[model samples]
Target: MLTIDSLSHRLSSYLEPTQINRVKRAYYYAEQAHAGQYRRSGEAYITHPLAVANILASIHMDHQSLMAAMLHDVIEDTGIGKAAISHQFGEQVANIVDGVSKLAKIEYETQAEKQAKNFQKMAMAMARDLRVIVVKLSDRLHNMRTLGALPAEKKRRIAKETLEIYAPIAHRLGMNDWRIEFEDRGFAAMHPLRATRLHASLQQVRGNRKTLVEKIQAAIELRLQRESIDGLVIGREKHLFSIYNKMRSKHKSFKEIMDVYAFRIIVEDIDTCYRALGAIHNLYKPKPGEFKDYIAISKENGYQSLHTVIIGTQGVPIEVQIRTKEMDELASRGVAAHWLYKSSGDDDSASAGSYDRANRWIKRLLEIQQHTNSSVEFVENVKIDLFRDEVYVFTPKGEIIELPAGSTPVDFAYAVHTQVGNTCVACRINDRPAPLSQQLESGQKIKIISSEKSQPNPNWLNFVITAKARAAIRHYLKNQRHTESVELGKRMFMRALTNNNLQFDQLNHDQITGLLEKTTSESLDEMYESVGLGRITALTITSILLPDSDENRDGTGITPISIESPDSLLISFARCCRPIPGDPVVAHLSTGKGVVVHREPCKNVSDLRSKKESLSDISWSPNVTGEFLTIIRVEVKSERGIIASLATRIANTGTSIEGIQVDERDAENSVITLTVAVTSRVHLANVMRSIRNMRSVTSVGRPKT
Candidate 1:
């Protein structure tokens, strides 16, 4: 039914000679490069590229993008490379091709990991060069359109990926038209039954509303003609998946979801958009609070449009979007819209700067990759940042900062400045004091109260949003851990002298260094860190340090045994369960790993009892005077500031914490379990009673077992 000549004629007004020549050249080159390749559908593989290029051209892309679109698969499927493409076309086209080609190289161990990492790369690349994603999206669009020949399993995989990754990316880029298509197609492939039902419902609605749409279009066109405003009006039906999402998310029936039918009014200029909006409002009653003027405050992705929802004929709610012809092109094609405007000889140097801010987040990915070594963590961080919902907030000066949805004030503080986040002590939302973990909503003005004395609280790690905030908090905690371990190692070394009946000055540094080297530890300092982290123990080092112990233990009634006794053995504490300050505990001697202490009733420790060979009796020292780790149970009511206030209150008692576990979700009560390090039973009792007296706190006691 459609011919090339007929399609060309339809596009004659916009397709200039230069564009046509490039398209022809690209066609010839792609055809040769993909000569031997055939698609699963039995069509020449070159046809796929051509189809994608045709999609781009339909959106009025310029010559360079068209060339890149045609040659996108040449490098991947064919043996063509970036260098060859650069030699044939210019570096610009080659760059686009290379970006897409790099994305095709990602191989992951899992499907989720693969999809997440692929999207991450694509996102970063698109942020750098928007054209890269436009080309890839167009390519995917064509592939999705022609996926009939693929197996059902493959179809579902690609479709689900498109729904999760591509559609969201399209939405972020503000490609509304393309977004709807991608979502609908993906939804159809993923949920065929739902898609079929939705399609049937839409068909029914279309049949019933045919007369209404015609009457509305005629009325609008006649009015525009009378006003001498030249423009195009196209009716847009709501996509099935979108309707499904709305129904699922909002719990609405199909009939309850208004604005299912909309009209796009494309004109020549911005002034005409407003004029058309006025005209449309005059024709129908406008819905209250349903108007958005994105033209004035364009989104981060360069989307600009005037939107309104109106009660159309028969009290049917209809959405209307007005934009210029250029805006429409950008709205549909997004970054690829650059290609269309570039052919007009417009100076793009100034306009290019508009996209720089959007690309900054992408640049951060490269920065993150440099710091991180593990692929799984990298993929995880990228996914957390990308797929997370967003909340738009304003700074003191009215500058907008978009953060992940459910982001606390801490994330906002970090978004402003890393220093501010690190030192953030308090916050104010809309001129009132708020907690750091308060969920930020759209349009709220926020202010962070910071202090030089303020350090990152471990509790803050539980509630902060945004990957950057989480990563920063984690990094800080790791650094803090290193610092604390170093300090603790020094103290433990000093304290051991009394137990060993040795003077610190009498120990040989060279001998100690040699002992550390045999264990493959870096230095005395590193050995100390290992000891503090419970990797090695005091007895293990004492044996290595005092190996010439014949003089020291000759008449003390003590004999060195090849295997340590199950009783009277020093054990290294497990931080996993952190049998802290005053908890009943026992030890398990792991082969070649020394003794590992655990809570007496801990499942991990209990499981080890079956292996009697590895079992060891561990008891608290009779002279134990310093702090020990204990997990205490504290019950409290869940409310804002409870965690922060509790943490502050606990810290005020000069007690260090091993960890805090909160599960305050039973019957309107919050149960908080805290693992604290305290000097004695007296100190722990005081701390427990103090916590019990605090507001919202009901009961505080040690674990009964």
Candidate 2:
């Protein structure tokens, strides 16, 4: 009833007879390997591989990839060895199988961890051979299709994994078809009740709109036909998950949302695509500021299309995408489109360039993996790249450098060349001096100014947002610690001589060890390094050597001061905030800076405590004090003159704006959050009440504990 020859009849345009024979052999071998095994659905386990292979074939995979997909699970699930597969098939097929098997072996304690690690591994695999992810995605697609056989928890886990791992990969690769199907299937599996309800609602909408979509398609087709344009027109409903997300995020009802239906036109070439676009605009009114021509500058994942949203019949908004057939294939299948293009005898120069660009990140991955001690670090670094929204900024020469969104000029400098980053003193974006932390927007031209004496600053660690920038800063700091520690140690030892404690130059290495051993430091070099790093305070050691001498320190007081009650305690508000009654509070005491109160959950405090153990014990005073000032966080939507309006509100209650910090530098939805200090509980409450009564205030509350 079924034969490779029969399948070849349909797929021969892509797969040769010899290729079909090889797949048949691989399939039979896989069947034998999984002989008596059965899936939870009680079907032969071998059917799963065949299904995956069929999915690959539908996408027109090459001979070796199809063969590898057929045997991908054998080594992982059926006890088949890699050596045996290598001996049977050539190394190419075995290598792909081994990559999949290795990925399958990396397990984790939690599903979330596993999913993150899996994406990491998938990225690594793609770096090595792009085909690995193609097969893996196809395998995931088949699993998603038959996911009903799994238990509810398993379904949710798998669907969530698809959403996090597979769907994003599909999007990054510009595989729109796979992305839509994967998301829709995952949404259905993960939220069956919600999915069912949305489906019923969509069906109700479709019932009244069937003729409407048909009429729109017919009109567009007639126009295209009149123009003698060769293209394929297809209509699509918006994916349910996407609709649900938009509804939830924008706080709009389903009925209030437009652009539910989209029509895509696939043409033969780029010229034809624009021609079709022109014809559509002539037929219907094109919405302003919604047209995008991705074909000219393709997405990083190699997706290219011309998209426009138009106002159609009955005041309905319809989205239209136009692209060449090759663009559509790549848009639909992403990297899998490479296999199809290769099978169809097209030159792969463009696809190869994309692969090369993506693979360039592998060296960085291996670099990150080497420095990282655990999967958590690996996951964190990889996530920076995974969900990164790209910003395309131009160099002085007009060449584009794409960095993660929110990237600063520091990142741009580093991207230009490591030397530029190392020597960068300042930057001018669009010929205007901007802060090093200023987020570069699209179409901005950046120029980095470097000086021969320039060196990386410790503060750059805060502003540089790219993984490469972060890694470089970390590497520079590591090296600087060794160099600075030696210099600081020499200075401290020389200073100790003045206190009549120890003759530093005359003392042998062993004596220095004795001093270091008291602090649990391994050696004299480490002791000096600690002093140099500011990890071990020089004053603390000086006190150990000279117990009674009051020394004039170069900077902050050398004596480690404690925050005990004084005759007139020098209490100051923490930089984390100026605390008030309702605010979550914490305190920081700098030797010379005095006590600084911060919002307990402030970014600076949270970051300091997690990374710097010395800062962790800082907490609030249970007893309320009229002298202690506190700060509250407020998030308000941006409006005309809202900042002035808010300041007026706070001023109305007689509150002092101790430190009003606006998130003006960020280009996201404008949220004017300011920290105002109040003298007492009553003062803070009054200020909050005044602010809340203002028309612009959206949410006002103390920071969560």
Candidate 3:
């Protein structure tokens, strides 16, 4: 049904004669490479690539992109190599083909992993040349079109990936045509029954509404004509996937959604576009607060238009959009639009601006990639940002920043810069003090209050919505843990050395190198990190350095490490027993969690003590200066102001109530669970005594498991 000659004829309208010839040459080369190969549908394999090239041509892609589309599958399907493609076509075309080819040389444990790795490879290639994604998108479009020959399960997998990734990517790049096509086909393949039912419903509704829709279109056309505003008026068709989504997401009947008539008015230029909008509003009163001027503040994807809702004739609602011809074209082709690839003048500034915005999005993906170590983690982080509903907020300086809805100041901080996010301690929204976790709304000005001594809180990950912010927070915490672990391991080894009377300064470079090799560690720092993370013990390494057979011995008479700094990243107090200052505690070496301190009598520590290598003796330092969290349970007689009175009493103890909950309640007695911060065990006892003095409080004591 398709051929190279047919595509060449179509390309002749815009592409040069030489460029068309080059595309033809690439086609013939691909044909020879796969001479005897046939596709699953029993057609010549060459047809697929040719179809892909045609798709690219429809967007008027440059010659190199078309050529790359033609030879995209040659390296994967045939014995041909990338070097041959490079030699035949130019290096740029070959690189694109390689980028688009399926990289399935190695075995993978699961489908998701394989997909993530392949996507990661493609993302790298995409960063190198933006055209690679354009060609790859075309290749995927052709595959999706021909997926009927595949098994049902395979079809669903491909369809899901297309909807989850490719379609959203197309939308983000401003390629509305490809994105809609992808969504419609992917939806159908993924849910054939639902799609079939929705399509039939749409067909029935279209027939019933055809007359009314035409009448509305005609009315708008007449108004524009009378106003001397030249424009093209046409009713817009709702894609099947969009209609289905609206039905499900909005929980509306098909008829309710169909009731809204949609139309587009394409004008000759920007000024006329606004004039046409005003004329339409005068014809039918526009619904208040329903107008959006995307023309002035374009979307992050570079889409520009004026959208409005008005009460049409017969009390029906009409949704209308007005835009210039160029803007409409860009909406379809997005970054692949021919104008973006060419040189720009004052008239082409919109195209150039749109292209730059697309580049910024791609580079953001690169930043996320750099912070991720696992391909799976990277894909998971990336998926979080794919479906952003934008909320435009401004900086104090009046520059607009586009962010996803429900994004917090932490998300905004990371968006500004990674360092700003890492150092941000507080925020001022609209010049008034606000919590950092407050969700930002449109038009609000944000000012981040940062401190030089601040570091990212791991808790930020629970609230920050953007992929960039989450990744940066994770990156900082992970690196911080490693640095702290190494320092703790070195300190532990120093204590071991003091006990053995072996000085760390006395060890030579060769001795340290030998010790690292003995542990199969790459460097001395890595061995220390291993020790700190509990992978190996400090005493073991100290014995290796001294070889003093008695030094490796475990148990009694060793000086316990003083936990003077309770807030050390390497030392974490266990929650189960909640051991505070002056409590007798023992430390357990948890792999990857440097040290976990538990009360000496804790049930968990009973079994852990048998493993001598894992258990260590630890003591609290005098004058430790941090608040420790402890839970206080109180049984109170049924009365008013019980919770408020307890909160006040807790606050009167020179501290504040951290949290409060009612665990169990009856008509006579109510159990109140209060989480309070105290300086020490003595301070906690005094708070409990103060609460016990209240008459409503029947009993007050600490709860232990």
Candidate 4:
């Protein structure tokens, strides 16, 4: 029964006569294009597009969006080209239409990949023009509304995707109304029996709920009247999906979930909003710790409201939300509210903030896309960023930072900027030193400690929840490996050149080019990377460059490279030997890992010695700085607080305990294994001597590999 006539009449509310006429023309064009096409329900396909346009009209979307909604399927279903739409409408409308068109299926991809690719392409479109996604969302909503005509398997698939992706997208955009609809409808289609039971239960309680809500709504109304506050009072309507989600998440029964009566108080201005809140609080005593002032600090989606709970008649809890009319609409329509106020000349700073917030989110998605390894990963990261319960923390300067619940300092650092996250080595919460992995809470102030030598640890991926942090860390590590590989390869090649009585700086361009060609490397850096990764040997490059220099490969020819910093990406100290500064160490060429340092006397080094190509002499510089992990065993009597004593002693020696484990030796004694941080052998010796002198300590020695 829906038609373009009703939509056109509604459009006349704000749109000019010319815009309405253009929309009508687009509708008629789409209708003619789909003359005989029918949906699975046997209804004319034109009805679907008309219904989609109606939904956009409800949001008061731009006239162009409405036109695109009408002709969105024309390009994909009717085989009409974008050129045709462009010739009819303007380029903007045509582009929106093309963007909303379903992509032709790409061959040779699995179903998951196909879905990821589709979402990736759609996200790019969303970044181009926000209207494209708004139109596509409206189209999806219409399809979801009439989903009963779909087959069971197909219906479930569509419902699942809606709940997983579309619903979250709506929530992220602050489209509360559309999000609730999407979730409820998708829930019904996915789980028919559960939805039916929940619906029936709600119907049974509707009478009592309405009565209670009305009684409390009247009390708030009378209080506001007495206070001379002009406000609109309305009882809150509970959505089925929200109710079900509450029951599942809170593990409560239907009665418990429905116990609290809810209402909304919409005032004329911000001052009146606060006045109305005071009036309501005077009528009913407010519950402590149940108030949130979101108006002062808007949510990430720019939702603003003052929420509080009060004890009402018969001691029953009443939940209320107070806001201005604009806030109320912005809460529901979200970014789309920008257009709702556009033609009315009501585009204020608040609406602009909401629109800009949504744009920032979309921009972040594009940034994550650049660093992601695959479309699947990008979509997964987007999904991670979509659903978040925010915690508001503060910076040292009193600026508020909002992050997802359970976010750590690393997540916060990346939220600030990529460079901050990459270089941050420590954190202070509330002016006290705290572990970087400690979960942050609301209202706490954070300070990040950064060092130029610090790099993002691969282990950060284990705890970082934000997409930006994960992507940036991965991107940095990927680039860092290449740089480290090049550096190591350069040193190895220089050593080989030195042994052959050749200076690398003196090599002619022709000679370097010939060597690169022989090594199948297109550039000098490529040859370095190949050698660094162990894909090709440094000796091979030297042999090819100087064919008569085979005799230069002697043990004495290899020079020792000073490893000032073992923390470099390519130079890692082997855990087996736990090499610290002042230890005689050798660089073991490890494929894919570059150089790994092992103590000379380590048993593992003896095995690697047979492969002379893998061996390169190395040593620590006197100025070597940074903590190194080493294991030490302490034989101690089982005295009370013996482990505590050892920890205190280690700290007194300026050595930090990374780990502590107890090994029960007998009834009266225990072997304490301590993994401590040390600068060099002298530092370790000082720590050992400090521990050995303790009364509980019988002996102290480093564990040899």
Candidate 5:
């Protein structure tokens, strides 16, 4: 039912005459483009754009934004092209329109992929120009308003999308009014019975509490007046969706949910907001530990307020929010408040600052997209970042850093800078040394310690919470694995050549080039890197690179040995026995996993030996060399020098003790477990024998595998 006249009238209030004419021109052009098209509701398609434009006008968006909203669907639904829009309106308008357009022409594997792709596109577009999202939000708002025309299945799908994505986006942007409306509408479409019951309950509650709410409002107003603080007191109704969420999350019934009747007090300034809080507290007792001051530390979405729970008449618990006029405007309208201030010729700096703060997360999404190539992964990460509650911590310099709740020091390091995260070695929380995975709390000061030689630990990914940290860590680990794999591949190839008595100097450029081409690698280095990364087995590459005569020599030339590499990254030793080089070994070809080598006598190996199809014969190569892990149990007299003597004897036998733990201690004797690094099983036995020769040592033996 919306018309061009209503949109024009709305625009006339803030837009200049020329700008209004431009918007009008876009309207007429869109009408012509959709002359024969009708919506599912049997209205002219042009009405949809007009309604969308009206929504933007209500938010006082700029002329360019309004034009984009009007012409948003033209590129996707009509014959009009982006070039034509650019020629007619300008690049900015054309870009915004293009940004909001969906990729309907392209085919996707599934509905989820298509949706993820669209959201990814929208996220990228919003990063470039935030106006695109504002316009898209307006477009979706009109669509949702008229969603009844669609089939039930489609309605549920769109409503679910709105609830999960659009509503959260609105909340992130500080558009509380739009966010609440979206949630309510989506809830009605997705769960009609629940929505109806909740609505009825809310209405009944309102009817029963009308008098009590009025009394509380009057009391708050009178207290503010008595304190000489000018304020506007209003009853704030709880949204049904929010109530439903609380019920579901807290497992509470409708009647059990308190704070159903909330109130807000909008004052003249920040100081007056605090004074109003004090006045209200004087009039009504505030509940213990229920006050929050957001004025000093605003939310990630730029919302600021003073929140407190108070016991009002009849001992009813009521939630109260106090904020200044500007803060209230922001709490209601969010980023839309920027347009309102701009159109009124208010301070540009304050508006820009607010917009920048809200835009930071959107910009971060774009950065994450650059590192993430999977549509599903990008969508999941975006959801994680959007839905979690945030915690505020501080840097060593006292600057506040906001992160998701349950974030760790590693997440903090990445939030500061990518390089800092890559090089982070350790961190201190609250001036005390803390683990990198320590869950950060609000108000704690964090100082990251970095070393140039340090690289990201793959284990960090297990606990990191933020998208940036997760994506950055994964990207770095992937690259690091490639680098190590390439080096290992090169070394394996050399060992193959040595076993065949064929030196690298014997191979000509043509042979190397042929080898690279056969492996589908760009260069020799890439082939080696691939081998090291386990993409292609070194044995396979060695067979291809060596002559048939060399290949026929004993299987010893290519036998898998000492899964360990120079960097200790290409292979991992099974923790069951911590196998050394001299132990007989077998490799298990796990699906989607490279070969895992285990000692032949290991209990785990014994259990898996039944699956002969998955087991491959492996042994230690003559050239194999690296430190191996082993545990030793030692029982000694409970004397001070006994511990030092055991360590000295072990060191004398060329073994290094990595760690030691006392199993038991008494007045005469003690038991200790030592994790030692040795070159081979023989080396470990020698060290154990050396320790056993000591007078204080009652027993020395390898720990049970």
Candidate 6:
């Protein structure tokens, strides 16, 4: 039903005669290109682009954006090319259209991979020109609005993608109109039952509280007039998705969601905004700890308001937001307000400031993309960075750094600079020494302690919340693993050579090159790194470097066993079965895991036994002495001091209990599992026997291999 005339009419408000003509030219060109195509709804495809252009026009986007929206699908959906678009329109218009198009020439392994690649391309385009995303959002908005025409499964998939990807992006860019609508529409499509229930509940509440809300609005308007304040008091109901989220997250019923009905007081200036807040607080008792003054410290998205909850008549709680007209416009329209102002040729500093503030996150997204490699990783990190509850902390210099909730000092350091994060050793929070993983709170001043020798610890990846921090830590740890693996591989290769009675100096360049080629490695360092990383065994490379003249007649081959040295970092015991000095064990060559010693009956060993070449005959040396973890289950009478008695008996055997868990329990007895550190299987057996000797403990045995 929508047509190009409606789009032209919407654009005519701000666009000049010349620009309006250009837009019309673009629309006709796109119309011809998409003449024979039809959408799922059986409507002419030109309607879709026109509808998309109309959506942008509603936000007062510039003529170029509107034209780009109109012609966005021409090159991708039609025989037209970017060159044709450039010849018809200008290069900028052609570039914008091309930016919105997905890479159709490439094949992808999966739908998710294809989606990730498209998002990657769109992000790059958005970085080059912000208008690309604006138009893209408009395109998505129109598609979502008419999503019912698609198949059920396709509808769900598209709706889910919109909710997860496009909606968050709209929020990050402060496009509240598009963001809220996207969420509401997507929620309705993706979760029809919940959306319907919520809508019905909202409507019922609206019917019941219609008079109350009107009375409250009247009372506030009267009070403001009495104080000689110029204010427009408007009543608002919370968005359905917002209300649903609150109910779901807080586990509250519809009626218990008190802030469902809210009021916004729009004043003329910032001082008046505060004055209005004071007036409202005086009029009604404000709920304690429910007041936030965002005017002093606006949200990262440039939203500023004074939010308060107060007890009104009949003990009913009412939420109120007070802000200036400018704040209200920004809150309602977000970044679209800047476009509106730009299209109207209103170069106001406030509008420009708001635009800049909203765009800071986009710059941060670019930084994240720079540090990330895989499309899936980039998309995932972008999602994490997008949907975060922010906490605003301060640096030593008093500058505010807004980070995601649960972000630690390490995340802060990384947010400050990649170099700072890499070299960060410790932090001082509120002038007290704090762990790097300490979660930061708002208003706390933090100072990062750095040392030139300090490098990122792999453990930091466990707690860092920000995507930037996680990406940087992962990048650093990857490089560190490569370096360490290379060194370990070199040592392993040399040891293999020495065991074979061949000196490393005896190998010539030609032989070394041949070895590298045989191993499919680029250089000696790569070969050594691969061996160290467990990608290949040292014995395999050694055999290639020095093959035996006679073919092997014995079953497979045997490698020397060595687990005695205290500092043998290349060998590690697999925690899956905890093979000790006296336990039957086998060494499995695992990629990037070095030589792993597992119990002979380990499930992993059985699974990998088909590859006989990768198995190495290994055993713990006679002097293999060190503490290893072993799990033992004990059946004990359910009574006080039973755990204490078990612990005492294990300690009496010189073994230390590391962990305990109540695996299963009843009124009479409980199965308690204990993980204790012992020197060998014999030590663990002696400890289990000591625990079994306790009167409270009925039976004790180790878990099956």
Query: Any idea how many clashes model 5 has?
Result: 3
Q: Extract clashing residue pairs from model 3.
A: none
- Return the candidate ranking by TM-score, descending: 3, 4, 5, 6, 1, 2
User: Residue 191 lDDT in model 2?
Assistant: 88
Name the runs in model 5 displaced over 4 angstroms.
103-109, 545-547, 550-555, 558-568, 580-595, 600-705
| Model 6 misplaced regions, further than 4 Å | 103-110, 258-260, 433-438, 501-509, 549-573, 576-589, 597-705
User: Ranking under lDDT, best-scoring first?
Assistant: 4, 3, 5, 6, 2, 1
| Candidate 2 C-alpha lDDT tens digits along 1-705 | 334455556557677778878888998899899999998889888888887777778878788888888899999987889899989888989988877776663433365566556656765677777778778888889889988788888788778767766787677666678888899999999889999999898888878878888998999999999999988999877779888888998998988764456899999988999999999999999999888777776666666789899998777888999988777667676667666766777767666555555566556666666545455657666667656767788998999887888899999998887779889989999989988889998789999999976777777877777777767767775566566545644554455454445576776776566678776887777776665444555656766666686764332222222222211122345544445544555544344322345666677776766654233123334554444445566777666788788888777777667666666534433545566655556777777888888765777876553
Write candidate 5's Cα lDDT for 528-604 as tens digits.
77665556665566567764654523334354435544234456677777777788877654533345677777878
lDDT of 4 by residue, 1-705 (tens): 777887888889889999899889999999999999999999999999899999999988989999999999999988999998999898999989888885333222338888888888887888889889899889889989999888998788888888888899998889999999999999999899999999999889987777777778787888888898888998887888889888999999989978888889999988888888888889999999998888888988889999999999898998899999899999999999998888678757888888898999898898898888788888788888998778889989999988888899999999888899999999999999999999998889999999987889999999988888889999999899999888778878888888777898898999988998888998889899887777777777788877876565544456536777657877888989888898888878788877788888998988876656467777787788888998998998998888877888889998989999999979998988888889989999999888888987888897777
Candidate 2 vs candidate 6: the lDDT winner is 6
Q: Give one digit per residue, the lDDT tens place, for model 3 in 1-705.
A: 788888999999888899899999999998998899998999999998899989988887888998988898888888799998999898999988888785423223356777788778867887888888888888888888989999998888888888888898888888999999999999999999999999998888889889998888888999999999989998998998898889999999888888999999999999999899889989999999888889988988898899999998788989999999889988888887744357222347667777888888888889998988888888887777767877788888999988878899999999999999999999999999999889998779999999998899888888899989988998998899999888877777777777888788998999988898889999868987887888888878877877746854763444436777556777898888877788888888788888898888888887776654477778888868788887888999988888888888878889778788995577889899888888788998999999999999889887764
Instruction: Provide TM-scores for the models.
Output: 0.72, 0.71, 0.93, 0.91, 0.85, 0.82
lDDT for model 3, please: 0.85
Q: Which predicted model would earn the best lDDT?
A: 4
How large an RMSD does model 6 have? 5.4
lDDT by residue (360-402, candidate 1, tens digit) is: 6566555555434455566666666656666678998999887
Q: Over the stretch 490-582, how does candidate 6's per-residue lDDT look in tens digits?
A: 866776777667798999998888898999999888898898777887777777866772322221344545677323445677777867778
Work out candidate 3's RMSD over C-alphas: 2.7
Q: Backbone collision count in every prediction?
A: 8, 13, 0, 0, 3, 0
Clashes of 2: 13
